[model samples]
Target: MIGPRERVPQAGRRGTRMAEHTGPGRSAVVIGGGLAGMLAVTALRGHFDVVTVVERDRYPADRTFRKGVPQARHLHILLSGGQRALERLLPGTVAALTEAGARRLYLPRDLLTRTPTGWQRRFDERRHPTLSVTRPVLDAVVRERALGAAAGPATRVEVLEATEAVGLTGDARRVTGVTVRARNGDRGAASRVLPADLVVDASGRGSRTPQWYAELGREAPQEVTVDSGLAYATRMYRPTARGEAPDAGVNVPGWPECPRGAAYVPVEDGNWLLTLSGVRGHHPPTDEAEFTAFSATIGDPYVHELLARAEPVSPVHGFRDTCNRRRHYERPGGVPDGFLVLGDANCTFNPVYGQGMSVAALGAVALRDTLDAAGGPGPGVLARAQRAVGRAAEPAWIAAVGADRPYVRGGGAKAGLGERLTTWYLDRLTARAAVDRVVGAAFRDVFCLTAPPSRLMAPRVVLRTVLLPRRPGLPRPPTAVEPA
Candidate 1:
């Protein structure tokens, strides 16, 4: 248990100078120890004298799955945009991930995507490189790096494992601290309040910040959700022989016409993860035989053909909490001073888009940059940081909502002229991207988070997408990477 006086002893030199300039006695409390929580600590390290992390689960000793993160068993990719942000926050992290057996897959070049129109041409521009690694490996490496950085001379960082944050200590005007209790199943264990100058909520999708706000007599932030009733199942496989697997991973995404999709991607240890997804009535099955059969129903048969040559090494696992939810914390009076919501706690996207982890990294970069600009924790620093976080999420949110709006039952609400026009242009652009390298590079740039979505609206891209004829991609999946 971490009390006001208790401090974890560790040593490092990364954030020493930054701590020297911080105001004495300033402290911060972060609620959660996952990637977001750790990154929040990274962003807060030099800004505070003491930083404490309250986590509900005990981390595993090795790079293995833990019960706290249920979605770890599925496929996860770190987009190029996220990769750069993560490296910025913790230098050399991308290299560390690659050294830990994570495969680097260049966008379009290393991934075979079946767009709504047809198979996307594999462009070897090598502009966007994504990291494909198991969630456990990714989490473990990040945890090790963050904890190391936290041990600097200026800020003292401590993590209380098997502990949960229950409520806030302050009222609606400003957040002052957090109330936490041990998770050891001791009914008589008393709760304690850890006072702080700032508090951050990075508790992911199951966050209880709203309830905490309500307890403080403040209205919770307004939330908007667009759920496509998406559900997915995953299973692990290994090729029967070495080098038998394809050089590139497979992606067959669902379209309005065909609402079933699948992705077979390579992970660490030469293992492959095959995830199948569908909306509402077309949810994929978890049964071994049914899971294999459903693969044949996606937009293309390439993924199914690959599945036939591999041997299953794990039982099928299913997950269904895929929804696009955003809490409007940037709105006026939405959050109190000295309090912030970040990562999935503020905005969660449909997992099929593979944007969550990347967005989290980008949000951390925004937080760090905002703090540096503000110089220190001043009167309106946290609020400004929160708004910066919201801005970081906007591009991903727009992309997700646009992609998912069509799948919503009854088409949800009627779109206005601007939205309808944008949708029409995007549909045509998607078709052009499948065959046009210039348009495809622009599309990947935006989607990978390396550039703003405005890149897609550039005159060159717009003219090509709007003026050129739509050409079909390769009728079948390419057996080898095509030269640029």
Candidate 2:
């Protein structure tokens, strides 16, 4: 357990009180050891002398599953914004992903997508790139990069595996540290408090920090949610030795009226990661034949076609807990000093948008940028961090929930005049993007988080949306290729 005596400065500083806490000049403790936790530690390293990452599971050295992360079996892709932020955190991180067999795919051109409007035309090239890799491989690479960077000459990143954070240790003024329980080989448990100047909760969707805040005499934060009732089923397939395999994966889009969607992405080891998903009543099945039959119903047949040539490596895996959830940390009365939430703890997306990892990376970048401006961690740090997480995640929440509402149950929002007008303009923009490469690229940029939603409102793009030639909606597959 870490205590006040363990708070000595690393190499660069000489201090007594300065080494005691992260505020002004001190150390930080981050709860959770997944990608978000590791990223948060990397971000806090420069400002804090000692950074500790605590997790309930023992982190593995390879690309394998552990108790805490269940989403590893499904399909996940990181957008360009996430890649760029991670690269900045650990200089050669992207290169490391490539070395570990991640597929670095160019947008639109490499993506064969069937949108509700029609088959999207492939563009020539792109300024932004998205990454395709299994969840475990991606997590492992990020953990390695961040943990390495956190161990720099003047900073320290300590990992406490097989440990769980019980609650916050401070009162209303600020969070001093976290109380944790560690399990030994003898099945014995020991509890203690690890003091710090700053504490970050990156414990993901199951976080109990709200209760901790209430314990400290603070009100709970406000929250908003759009539960689309999304469910996902995934299967992995390896390439056959007899035929040459293509590098690109296929996507079959859902109907504006229906809720089903499918995507096949190529990842490491010459394997294809396929996911079939639906909302509410149209949920995909787990049976092998039924799963394949469901894939045939997508707008694009390419996913079904590819399944014919590939062989399944694993049984179908499914998840149904995806919901668009957000906590309004920026609002008044609740937020405390020395403590902040990052990644899924602050906001969780529908996941179909593939924004979770990227948003986490953006959150880490925001934390770093905020720290740089403020000089060091202090009373206002958590507030500023809340703003940063909000800025990083709000656009994604809007974009995902915006498109998703028309199809899911209770899709309509508090339909004010401004909301109605904005929705109308966005619908027109989506219709135009079906045929225009320039418009498509711009739209893809926003989807990938390389740019903001306001970029679509620029005069050039707005003119294109207003006076552009209309085209048929996205195309359906030529024929329904029944999966084998």
Q: What's each prediction's TM-score?
A: 0.94, 0.89
- Residue pairs of candidate 1 with colliding backbone atoms: none
Q: Can you tell me which runs of candidate 1 are displaced by over 4 Å?
A: 1-22, 410-418
lDDT by residue (tens digit), candidate 1, 1-484: 1111112221211221233434577899889888899899899877888888888887765678878789999999999999999998999889989988898999798999888777888878899888999998998888778777776777877787888899998988988899998888897879999998999999999999999999998998998888889999999999989878989998888988999999999998899999999999899999999999999998888898888789999999999999989999988787898899889999999999899999998898899899989987888888888889999999998778777877877644455575566667778888898888889888888888888888989999999999998887788886666676
Clashes of each: 0, 10
TM-score top scorer:
1
Q: How do the residues 129-162 of candidate 2 rate in per-residue lDDT, one tens digit apiece?
A: 7789998888887776676566565576677777
Residue 64 in model 2: shift from native, Å?
0.8
Q: Which candidate is the best by lDDT?
A: 1
